[model samples]
Target chain A: TPFRIQNYRTLAYVLTTLVYLVIGAAIFDRLESTQESISYANLQTRIDVFRQQHNMSKSEFENLTRTVESRLNYRKKQWKFIGSFYYATVVLALVGYGHAIPYTKAGRAVTIAYALIGIPMWLIMIQSVGERLNSLITFVLKRIKRHFKRKREPQITAMELLTCEALLTVLTLATGSYVFHRYENWRYFDAFYYCLLTLTTIGFGDLVPMQKDDYGSIGWLYILFCIMFILTGLTIVASSGNLLILRFVETNTKRSRNERYEM
Target chain B: TPFRIQNYRTLAYVLTTLVYLVIGAAIFDRLESTQESISYANLQTRIDVFRQQHNMSKSEFENLTRTVESRLNYRKKQWKFIGSFYYATVVLALVGYGHAIPYTKAGRAVTIAYALIGIPMWLIMIQSVGERLNSLITFVLKRIKRHFKRKREPQITAMELLTCEALLTVLTLATGSYVFHRYENWRYFDAFYYCLLTLTTIGFGDLVPMQKDDYGSIGWLYILFCIMFILTGLTIVASSGNLLILRFVETNTKRSRNERYEM
Candidate 1:
């Protein structure tokens, strides 16, 4: 009966996830498709006008644009020492912004090998850091509780720890978002979006910080700050994820262990 | 002493990771920077020639190129029904190829909300599936062992499980790479890179499958296959990661428990 119940629960989860995905897809399509088509048409009109004005054929204009776009891209100095460090951070974080990916086969091969080793090491490091973070939080919480309620023994519940972690996650996001908003000159909401994306390791690279102009003027301090933000932010988020997922994993492990014992 | 040793180990891990990142950065810079500068200069020359031939000013050419580039980007129809599903899958997986992100404010807002719930749910789903996969493998392995050795109890070791998981991972990558290479018309190495990037959830978007032309001809089956590939590949990889990390986590947890008992 327990096995059957587990099966049903997993099935329900699968179906719910399927439905959830479809709903998300439909909402995105509805919200974005019209705007996408309208913008496409507007851009197409602009392209036609530019071509006519320049008296250039489609292929000629395409060639010219490709060269110009690539030229603009290369102006960024993305393979420099600092930029390469940024690349390594993203790769280790599994963010993979693809803003300035390897152009050569060797670079690609190296990236694959680097990631193969780096990602797991990064994961373990974060999880270890996260565990220490949890212990620290527990200690601090107990201390606070003892100070407040001296009449009773200091006690902390799982619920209390979860609440603390949840608040920390939100606080980290808020502060990080504000910092990025100020630094990147992006709108507050967009900065928040960027922070969340980066923290989650989605890293769309739609808006990355420390561009060519920033590197030229902002100095290494800003670059160091950004990398630290990514690393620290992920550690905090992973701590939260670890707490939530560990309970589920433990339950699954226990159920399997019970089944094994029964057998 | 154990605590101190554990601390030292973590410190060593941290230092090693830092050194690894630095080495990777140096390599990337060395391999890619010179090529980058040369290509940049080449593109600059092409841009200059085109500007002189077209009799356009720098700003005028920049504007033309901007509009043309945006137009080219929108021709892909990335917000359609199927593409939207792909987006949802990427967001859930945290792959985030980002070839086409939501352009609207509403879309970004919804995305954040969606991911807040969806990512954890997806994580649980994959992890549960991975556990089941491990059980299935164990059962199959036992059966095979029994068939080969009738007198034996067919006990499987942790090492055996690990080896099987690793072999399964390799097999999955090989077969998946071959399939994508055939379907997407990419070089075998590129296809393998795409598969690795995807399974690791890096998703650089340097090379994504299923373009507009593919959509026109490939139908829904290919879409389904790609989605399934991502989900299955991630589950397998996560299982391997789970085995490796669980051992480390258990050691850490046991050490902490012993410390608490001593206290």
Candidate 2:
């Protein structure tokens, strides 16, 4: 029924993911253009102003570029570290590392406040992920029930679970290699590695595929590549998420039966 | 029989996750201290450093403090933006943006090489997550078989799923809020926001709660939280994985039969 609780919830999840994905893509695309502009005349103007203010000669200007480059490099590495810190924190989901922000009291106050807003935002996200999962679980359970309804040992040996593993490997390999080919010249093993990292989202940023020489022309293609990568990542996570839910139900069910029998 | 494959795999998962949590916590604690030291000089030495670097009078120093404070505010916000970028890259499991790294051809080459390395590193991780998932699936399928082997249906229903959800929620909340309270004076909601972000690894770092405080004082506690939160996440994923496996097995069984009948 259109109003069934599960159906309604599934509809909501579909709509939300679709909406968020579109919004996210839009924002990413806008940012990509903004980043492009940051290098255009505006940034050149800012550099010229800074150099003039410093009363720099051409040689001094070059020296200053070296110094600035060094500083930028240092900052790049530092910021990358911070970025990695963010990656780790999020993966660990601790959200406690303050290296990404101020450590002062006023800063802390704002941080605390932002966190208050962020918490529920995350909770909403979790609920959405859970709802998606619930829908999936419902879908799977129904399928199993239908199979068992046939009322036979059904000539199915469960060892075929290994076959699923085989299928997963093949799929992972095929998809991984294709992505790798488009982004890099990795061998099969390396392609598999890229797939692993991208799918899992470890995202060290140490191993990102660099932006190609767009020659200012491939920007749209690059954007498309990124957006496609994000969607592919969601699929991998969704599949992995599906696997994780299966284990949870199994463990809990056993624990409960054990407790009851013991009682 | 003494060393069942399923049991061994579960043990491996627990051990790997346990080890990763330890290393993750240790690194974070050290990083916190290093970052805290960046602004430190003891209150007395601070005067000397300020005098030495910029040659400021007390009044001038105080005035300069305003500039520094404003700069810090800007930096904090900027860092949070960077952190958010890193997070977006991580969760999507694909780093597309070139914020803190090279965007040139040389840079792309580096990224490609780096990705080649990163992919396998990620694969190893997937294998670990995969192992845990496999055991969990086998464990659940065994249960389902026994469940149907019985004369009664055991009243399988949605209520049972709630029990798992409750555990996941509690486990997340307990670890999340505690770590949040570690460095920030956030309300419980703030703590919760921090927790949800951390668990899901969405990691919008605008509200980092710890670091620059307590170093090793709560090191063990921090580690414990990481272990618990991720385990809970993994467990939830496992439950769904089990359901999907069952469904897949059923579908394949049916499809193969249908093809044979048509033939």
Candidate 3:
């Protein structure tokens, strides 16, 4: 009974994970095969031949699988984090990307409601956690500095930080537009347009850069810029928005206590 | 000038959003035109018609657009606070969901990297956040009870909360397997497989619940259960994972203080 309770669950979880992998593969393969001349049979045969050439031991094969899996797992976590951020940003970044997924009528209705409530809820939640984490991170960093270097702390309050972030947002948004104009084959407005779309991660595919032959040379540059944009966006959230919420929470809790005392 | 700056930025963001919508419609229309049985002139006419539908009046559209945009912005500011928790939870919630958008090799590389780092981070982060949120949630709830209802507080400690979660993890995995077996339409593994995948919002499409079924009887129930599963999963991350991290941080901070004093 105990064994079934534990091992059964482990088995279920593993199988569940594998099913996800297979489904992902099926969708990807189907799409890829549709776009290319490769047959599923040929792909399988290629895998078989490749496996034979390696002639890997069962243990070796498993180790290789695990290595590949670990890599996949890592990527999943990163994207999920990023993607969750992306979804949250779209909903809460006040950008209103309006790209909520709704594949059916019922789903659409729910999505509309989700957009109404879920977006705000997510925004609040993100802000709350972001502030708390920042405090935790900053607190740790300060201690390390004090312990080792004994550096004099030049105090910059949270208000100053907010103003700096607002300026950064405008600058980053403007720079994003400029890059879209300069490197890619877009008109100035279109460049600004593309920057907004991509940074927002709406990824409308209308003016996606680095795809045309001339612009293709800077593909990696575009990707790097995207990563930077995302990180910068995160910094903005981590700083001002989070601080506001934490202050609100602390203020409310204190106000409640004071009111109780007065009563 | 302040008003003008806000107006211009708002317009820029809006115009950019519209460009995507119009362009998206144009792309689809042109594609449809190419595949049509009608004459090229008629096809061109149809494409123009589609564009007309997507175009917006400057005055009339602006106010409504701003309404939604402003609301979304308010939400975004709020969300930016706690967004980190979601980001972290998503990274390591579960591992190896296979949904990918491989536009280029570099994109693929980033995707691959995400799989490697993001998966464990997702799990670890979720576990960490869940612990903290759970403790805080319980702690607050108990305190509220003490304040309002004058009830004795439940001793909801960290270890107990964590043990319960670990037990749930095994339960989820096992329940997934047994459910897969009962369904039998899915392979013995795929049902439990997608439970984790979808629960985590990886939505890799390798497996989906009731993939080929009509919503004859249990449609609402199915959707409801899925929602419940996801919410519970989130609760786990909020309570268990976050609390543990906070505790770790507190311990380390304290440890260093002791060290500094000793030195």
Best of the candidates, TM-score = 1
Per-candidate chain B TM: 0.92, 0.39, 0.36
For model 1, the chain A TM-score is: 0.92
DockQ numbers for every candidate? 0.59, 0.05, 0.03
The C-alpha stretches of model 1 lying farther than 4 A from their native spots are: A151-153, A215-218, A260-263, B1-5, B215-218, B258-263
Q: For residues B143-219, could you state the per-residue lDDT of candidate 3 as single tens digits?
A: 76588887675554557657766666667656655654454366554565555434434343334343333445765
- Quote model 1's TM-score: 0.94
For candidate 3, the TM-score is 0.37
> Could you give candidate 2's per-residue lDDT for residues A104-192 as a string of tens digits?
44433433444444433332233233323333343444456558785433332223433443454457557657765665665665565
RMSD score of candidate 3 (Å):
22.8
Per-residue CA lDDT of model 3 for A1-263, tens digit only, reads 43233334334544554344344344334334332233334444544554465454546434433333322222211112223333333333333222222223333333234344443343333333343344444556566767778787734356655565566566876887788687764667666654543443333333444333344666667755754564455445444544553344334334333222111
Query: Candidate 2 DockQ category?
Result: incorrect
Q: Assess each prediction's global lDDT (C-alpha) against the native.
A: 0.82, 0.41, 0.42
lDDT of 3 at A198: 44
